[model samples]
Target chain A: MTVADVLLLALGAIAVGSGALVVTSTHLVRSGFYLVVSLGAIAGLYLVLGAELVAWVQVLVYVGAVVVLLLFAVMLTRAPIGPSADLDRPALPAAVIGAGVGLGLTALFVDAFRWTRFPSPDPGTAERLGEQIFGAWVLPFEVLSILLLSALVGAIVLSRPDIGARKAEDA
Target chain B: MPLWLDLLIRVAAVMAGFLVLPLVIGQAEHKVMAHMQGRVGPMYAGAFHGWAQLIADGVKFVQKEDITPRDADRTVFRLAPIVALFPYLVVILTIPLGPGLVAQSLDIGLFLVLAVLGIGVVAVLMSAWASANKYSLLGGVRGAAQLLAYELPLVLAAASVAMAAGTLSLPGIVEAWRPWWLIWQAPAAFIFFIAGLAEIRRPPFDMPIADSELVFGYMTEYTGLRFAFFLLAEYVGIVVIAALTTVLFLGGWHGPFEEQLGWLWTLLKIFALSFVIIWFRVSYPRLREDQLQRLCWLILVPLALAQLVLTAAVKSLL
Candidate 1:
């Protein structure tokens, strides 16, 4: 394998490891935090693929919004930040599942494609992405806006306390 | 230089830039403020100006204690800086300094840069939240609100430019503009630049990390070089956004003298834009958080919408 291939594989492995740790961790807060490593590395993989728009969207949506929201939820709920949570119980099963899935994915990737040397894209990826977004992906683009608007409204709704007083009056 | 060596040189150049530019900005800020107030801010740091201020600060930060709050989520707290500093490297990777001079000119450079730029916001949120201090938490909350509000207009403005330019690659965007898009669509350019400034968290719209209310906000508890790291990241961000602004709207490395001294023109434009950022810092007092929110929603958003319409109308007519 080429050096770049090796590097990508190593980084991908690291990403999967961290992501598994994120989900499998007992502490809800640390799990949210570990999601950053998982997501950022995946974005790095996206960068490697020449899909700059997809890569950035991965960062923008997952790192910037989703992970932050997860952390906020953890913090607000307090997630019982303490030593008493079940930290070790899930590790064994998760490790097994993770290893199996990792091997499976890597095998599939290696087996499926006739890999060739792809010349790296010349710069101005964002501009090209914008063009594609408007031209080919215009439907998804508009739908994404609608989705984001809904998410914003839902997040605002969910985050606020009921107060109970306003609910009764409205009812 | 060999290919590897050339790569090293570019990395070093960007690192040196990341390291030095903030110090220069600090000195310039001091000098400017001193001139305004009829007093010299720093006369003793070095020969011409207090040029060695960031250097001195860096050494001090390193020498100083790295404190972690006793109750903090130490892992995430530590992860925060890495997350914060990582984007700069990714952004600089795509940045074309001179003719054929970018470190790695990936085709998707603009997308990579903007994506990385968008990602940096999270570190601020994470830092503030993980600190567990009330002010830090509040700052993170404000940052989340501020980022979501402005991101759409920022993307829309950029997309409008991309529509006119007909490219997604940064270098392509530059090449597409035989005459700068700024002249054809000054209104779009204006909206994008202003929104980009807000996105970068420069005052007067820097509500997320408001200094007065939150006491340095997200990086409050971070001490020593870690705090220095955060500040360095901020200035680097200012440079990147300004560079993007120049590339997209200013016709990148396409000036009269640029053919001869390409880096010079790029830096001159970038440095000029940076001055405006610093100038805003000097002149205007920070906007109220709610006011910052309202300004984006009511003013800039409407302006961007109008620009999009104007652009579409002109394209159809032409």
Candidate 2:
């Protein structure tokens, strides 16, 4: 196998293994850290796939912001140093769902590509990605921004009860 | 030299810079702060104005007991220092000292640097939570909140410069820089420098580690080499922040004898900015937590947005 293929396989293995640890680890804070490892491995996979912008953004938004927030929340609450017995739940249903999803994705991928090798695309630099987004995907991009903006507004309103209280009182 | 030798030399040079420059900045801080406060600092260690004070400190840190609290999570507590220090090492690799002088240059060098730097927060959170100290946990939560708030303006201010330069590469941004940009990008530059200071948790933006209130904050539970690592990381952070401010705003490697002495110019600017950073520490007290948040969201964020718009307008015009 080519170096990229081998690297991809290794990173994928790490991602899957850490992802399993993220779900199965009884320690809440440790599970959050495992999620970080899983996400970081996925970013490595993106790097191996030659999507540098996506890889770094994945690290930035997910690892840097999302998981930090998750860890922050876990810490803000009771995060016992050792594993808590209360975290334990029936594993059978979770395993069944997980396996079904994994198998379905594998089957779909196999059905679609079936061992065919396609030429790799050029690396996705910021400039090229920008062109793609602004050139062909402008409408969807704009829609996404609007959606995010609304979500942001919703959050602000929810967080500050006084924001809409005065308006209602005036009415 | 062969390709391997060339790569080896570059890596060694970056590593040497990474290890040495932070100590230099630390010594500078000691001398500057001492002088500013009208006191003689570190006069005995090396007998030459304590040139070896940090080295002495290093030995002391190494000799001390490595203590992990009984209640602490051993694994995560042990892991924190490495997490704190590693990002700065990665960042230095991408920073260009001169034309073609970088150890490794990525197409998205600026983004990579910022992203990696953001990961440093996880270290603080990890240590704070793993220590199982109420003070450390409080400090960590404050740090997260502070970082989360300031991150917006920090990224936004950087985005302004990236927009102005029209490339996310650090070297490309320097190449795109002009003398007039010192005036044009001044606001964005100011925002960037201040926000960068906050990002690194320097004084006046140091609510998270307000030692007076939180007893070194997240670092309260740490001792020995781990504590020393945190200190080293802070100094390295200062170096990174100063270097970034130099590169992004002050026109890195852009001085007389442009071809030669380019790296010297970059170093000069970095040291100058580092001096200013120290001056800031000596001049201002730690900002209150609410004041810090208010300053970031109310002032810096709006100002960064305005600067971004100005950059866009100027870019469109030119």
Candidate 3:
């Protein structure tokens, strides 16, 4: 209907298509690359929805760090040159789960909004996002930081064989 | 002028800078490295101290045969060079040359720049995996590790500057920069510079492509024009790092007659920083990977965190 609507639809299609490819692709590395495309399209979707900060953060955190870590693990393990037959698994269960989730989400959103039109919100700049995080969402934000810190310490402990060895031996 | 024309001019300007500046830096590296080694670098290319050497190299690359290995993944291998090169071009677009001199300045320009620049790692990964070469894979993995490690400090240091300035926009940060910040933000600047060098895989941080060991790392399997693009991307990366350092840390466009001649000041700072980067390459041997990781995690990250605390304190006080 509108230019913004067109762009939104286009980006959504790209995101969904590439997301499907990410799961279905036989090549492990290619699947990772497809994930990049899917995440990037989601970033574009964020942009279309006027969440600039979230869009870039998506690119930075998801496409940049997370997927690279995924690819890194894949490369560290067996990354065959081409598609390996072993990557194939039973599709029926996965397809059922995927369809159910997709349909449930679609139904929930459709029921919630139900053809309502609302005024466009102001674009989410870094300042506004920061205020929201530190102001209203501060409690959950701090909890998330604590969770991340615990995970980090856990990782370090696991990685360092000597970290708890002496204490364990004494015990 | 219409909107399209204005956009066209900006795009054109960015493209010109993207094409020309890297060649200039490449030539400078050639001459600088040669002179530092007591040798004349390319005295015959453009007839005046080998000014055309990079141009000559470009021509040669263009004429060479592009090769994809038999074992390589065809699509990904071919796509790698473009992936390697595109982010620098995008990152350069948001960099402010002076007040109102940027191509397109977003409210979150600094964040966008960092985000786009981070994607360069994916290019390395793509190339490495697609090459199907042991050396390439090793190089890519090392590169990814190094980039990931340094990325924390890099973002932290930049975050300090953003906090100090109270703005996420490059131009606004420059406007906020005071002469005194040179001392106050010096530690963050140093950390940022070091982390940035590691990000671009420049020496002495260049373990990924340590020629003595890995044989050019992720780029081992690349040949001809594709290899040339990778080389160009490296030079362009140098330019991006230098420009960002100039903009973020060194008081961009803050020299004499800054209102009129600000772009010139920015360019001067960028070139000066680029020379230092080159000097670094010539001076230091490639770092051992363990030492590199240690320097990042043990040194730069903690220092950057301290700098952030200091910045917040200073900002609150001011």
Candidate 4:
């Protein structure tokens, strides 16, 4: 196998390994950190696939912003740094459902592709991606912004009970 | 030089530069700040101007006892300093000190630098969590908040420059300043410097490591050589940020007779920026945490975004 293939395999292994640890690790803060590793490895896989912009967005949004926020929440809540007995839950049902979903997706993908191969496309540079985004995908992108805006408003409302109380008094 | 030999020499130079540059900058900061405060700093060591003070400090740090708190997470505590230092080494590889002097010239060099720098947050978080001290935890939490807050403006500011230059490569950005520098984008450059101060956790944006409040912040529990690594990483970070500002705004290696002596010009700009950082530390008081966050989200973020849009518009028009 070539270097790219080897690197892909290594990254995939790290992603899967850390993902498993994220669920199983007893320490709350460590679980958040493991999630970072998993996301980082996934970003590495995106890089290996020659999607530099997507890979960096993954690092920036997922690994940098999302995971940091998660860790901040955990620390703010005074999460136990050591193993906590309460974290353990009944795993059989989760395992069964997870396995079924995983297998079904794998079967669907393999059956649909059926070992077909296509010519490799040109590397996706940021310029090309920008054109595609702003030219064709602009509507969906704008909609996504609105969605995020609403989510921000919702979050603010939820965090401040006084907003609802004031509105009720006004009514 | 042969290909392999050239590669080896570049690696060696970068390694040596990383190892030695921090000491020089640290010493310069001490001396400059002292002189500003009307006191002599490091006057005795090595006889000249306490030039050997950092050397002595290094020796002392190496010889001290490496202590771990009983409740500390030993593995992460040991790993944190290495993680902190890793990005500084990686970032220097992509920065061009002169024409054709960079160790690597990836197209996504700027993105890689910013992303790698983000990893330092993980190191801070890891050290803070592992220390298991209330002060350390408080520091780490502040670090997380500060990083998240400042990173938006920092990336947006850099994005404005990248848009103006039409390339993310450090060398390309430098070359784009054939006739003029991105300092023409004065507001963006100003936002970048301000946001960058927060990114490096320097004053007055040094809320994470507020010494008076948090007892050196997340580094409270660290001692000996491990502590030295943390300090080294901070100074190296200061140098890196200064170099980045020099490259992104002031024009990297662009000066009189720069064709033959470009690296010297780059060094001069980098040190000038470093001196400004020292000046900030000496002159400005640290901001309150809320004020720091508000300055980033309310002021800098909108300013940087507007600058980015303006840059894009100007680029398209031209």
Candidate 5:
């Protein structure tokens, strides 16, 4: 195998392995942090696959902002930070489910393709992605903006303390 | 050299250089501060101003029992420092130091640098939370929020420069300068450099890791060499950010009659900028979190966008 193949495989392994840790880690805050790692590693794999802009947005939005907010929410709520919560519950079934999905996805991808084909584009990839995003995919881009606005409003609502004590009093 | 060979050498040099630079610069900063304050700095440690300090630090870190607190989450705790230092290493790769001095001058140099540097946020958050420390966790959350507020203006300010210069390629942008881009985009570029300092969590904007508030924030639980690594990363980070500013706003390697000086001109320019960064750290009092956020979003963002328009209009007129 080429060194590129080895490095890419290693990165993939790190993403999947640590992603499981993100779910299983007993400390709720740390779990959110690991989610950033999983997302970032996925971004890195995107880079290796030559999707530089997507990799950056993954770092920017997912790792940089979403996980930060997750940690913020985790901080506000008093989750058990210690061995007070049990860590090991039912990993055997989780392992089975995880492996089955992986195999199923692999089968689907393998079955769908007769031969692999990819378009070669010059770098300055952010600009290239910009052209595609604003040109052919402009409708989806506009829709994505709406989705982002909704998510932002939802987050602000959930974070609002005024809504909480007032609603409790109303109840 | 072949590309593979070149890559290997550059990687080794960066890794080895990063390992040692902190101790050297730490000593230098100490000595300079001491001179400024009228005192002798470390007169000992290998018969001088602590020349072997980083080596001793490295040895201590290697020997220290890697600790995961009883209450701490194991997986994330182990991974945080690695993630923190990795991107710091990755950023120095895109410097485009000179004709032969860069590893790979990827076209999206500035954005890639910003993205890599931004990912360091995750490492800080993980380290803080995984430690299971109250202070560290608070620090992490504050830092995250602070990052969001500052990052928008930082990018906008950078975009203003990119608009004025009309290229995202670091080397190409540098070559476009007739005088200096700094002279042309003085208003925007100055804002960009100052905002860059805040982006890196330097003093005056270091709300998340404030020593007085969070007691070293995410680093509260760390001790000895592991903490040393964090400190090293901070200093190296200062250099990296400064180098980026040098490349983007300043005329990178360009200078008056610099042909004879060769690589010396670029090094000098970058080092001069680095000294200014150090000067700011020594001079400024830290800003509060809200103040930092307001300055970036409410002020700098508008300022940069306006400058971007002004620049484009001027280009069209001239």
Candidate 6:
């Protein structure tokens, strides 16, 4: 195998290994940290796949913002930092479901592709991605903005119960 | 020069730069802050304006006890400072000190810099969690909140610059403004500077490590060389942010007589920006966490979005 193949294997192993740790680790915060490692390895996979923009964006959004937010929520709620006895639940169901899904996806993917090699595509440069995003995907992009806007409003409403009470009294 | 030899020379230069630049900037910060506060700073360390103050500080840190609290997570606590400092070194590799001087001029250099720099938040959070102190945990939580609040605007502001330049490569962006720089993109530049300050957790946005209240916050339990690493990372961060601002807003290595003296111009601009950071520290009082969050979410984020839209419109029109 070439260097790229070796690197991909290493990164895939890291992603899968850390993903396992994320679920199995008893420490809640440590699980979140392990999630970072998993996500970061996925970003590395993207980098090796020659999607530089996507890779960095993955790092920026997933590892940087989402996981940070996850940790923040955990800390705010005073989640157990150490191993908690209650975290241990019967693992048989989860294991069976996980294995089934993993095997099903693998079989489906293998059947569909069947080791066919595709021609190398153009590098996904930022400029090209911007064009695709703003050109063909503009409608969905704008819709996503509205979705985020409504989510923001919903979050505010949920957080501040007094606002609803004030509106009810006015009505 | 051969490709490998060229790579070796650049790596060596970057390593040397990393070692020396932090000391110079740290001493500058001390002298400037002291002079601003009407006090002499470290007069005896070097005997010539305390030139050796950072060196003295480094020696002291090395000699001090490396303490780990009994309750601390040994592995994460030990690794945290390395995590904190490593990104600064990596980010430096992509920054263009002068034309043809960058260690690796990737097409996505700017994005890579921002992405790697974001790792600092993870490092800080890790350290705080590992310390197992209430203060450190609070500081880490504050850092997470601050990062979430400010990072959007920071990226948006930088996006506006990239939009105007029509490129994401640092050198390409620099060359785009050959005639004039993107400081003309004034609102975006201002947003970038402010968000960058928050990103680095400098004074006025330094709620994370609010020394007065949190007792150095996430760094409360750290000692010796580990503590020194955290401090060094902060100074290195200042220099990185300042250098980035110089490249993005001011012209990178662009001045009169620039061909021969491009690196000099770059240094001058970086140090000038560093002085502004130091000035902010000396002059502005720290903001409350709520106020900092409000400023970011309510004001800066929208302003940055508007700036991005404006840049897009202007770019298309031009």
> What are the per-residue Cα lDDT tens digits for candidate 3 across A1-171?
999999999999999999989888899899999999999999999999999999999999998899999999899987888988988796898899989999999999999999999999889988899999999999999999999999999998988879779768989
Residue B289, candidate 6: alpha-carbon lDDT: 89
Q: Which candidate leads in DockQ?
A: 3
Best by lDDT: 3
Model 1: residue B83 alpha-carbon error in angstroms: 2.1
Q: Taking the tens digit of each residue's C-alpha lDDT, what string does model 4 give over B1-318?
A: 799998998899999889888888999998999999999888998999899999999999999999999988888888999989998899999999999889888788899888878888888889999998999999999998999888888899898888888898899889887545444578888998888888889988888899999998889999999999999999999889999988888889998898989999999999999899999999999999889888988999999988988888888888
Show model 5 residue runs off by greater than 4 Å.
A1-27, A82-124, A137-171, B2-4, B38-40, B46-68, B257-262, B315-318
Chain B vs. true chain B: TM-score for each candidate?
0.93, 0.99, 0.99, 0.98, 0.90, 0.97
Q: What is the TM-score of each candidate against the true structure?
A: 0.82, 0.98, 0.98, 0.95, 0.82, 0.96
Q: Which stretches of candidate 4 lie above 4 Å from their native place?
A: A157-166, B1-3, B178-183
Please give the lDDT score at residue B247 for candidate 1: 81
lDDT per residue, candidate 1, B64-153, as tens digits? 999988877787677788788878867877878777767777665665666677777778777876786777877777776777677767
Clashing pairs in 4: none
| Interface RMSD of each candidate, angstroms, one decimal | 2.7, 0.8, 0.5, 1.2, 1.8, 1.2
lDDT of candidate 5? 0.74
Fnat of every candidate, listed in order:
0.51, 0.84, 0.78, 0.36, 0.58, 0.60
Model 1, which residues run further than 4 Å from truth?
Answer: A1-12, A47-52, A73-171, B178-180, B316-318
Model 5's C-alpha root-mean-square deviation from the true structure amounts to 4.5
DockQ of 3: 0.87
Looking at candidate 4, what TM-score does chain B attain? Answer: 0.98
Task: Give the per-residue lDDT digits (tens) of candidate 4, residues A98-136.
Answer: 989999999999999998998766676677788999999
Q: Write the per-residue lDDT of candidate 5 for residues A56-97, one digit (tens) a residue.
A: 878877877777777767676764565436665767987899
TM-score of 2: 0.98
DockQ versus reference, model 5: 0.47
Better by lDDT, candidate 4 or 2 = 2
Worst 10 residues of 3 chain A by lDDT: A159-168
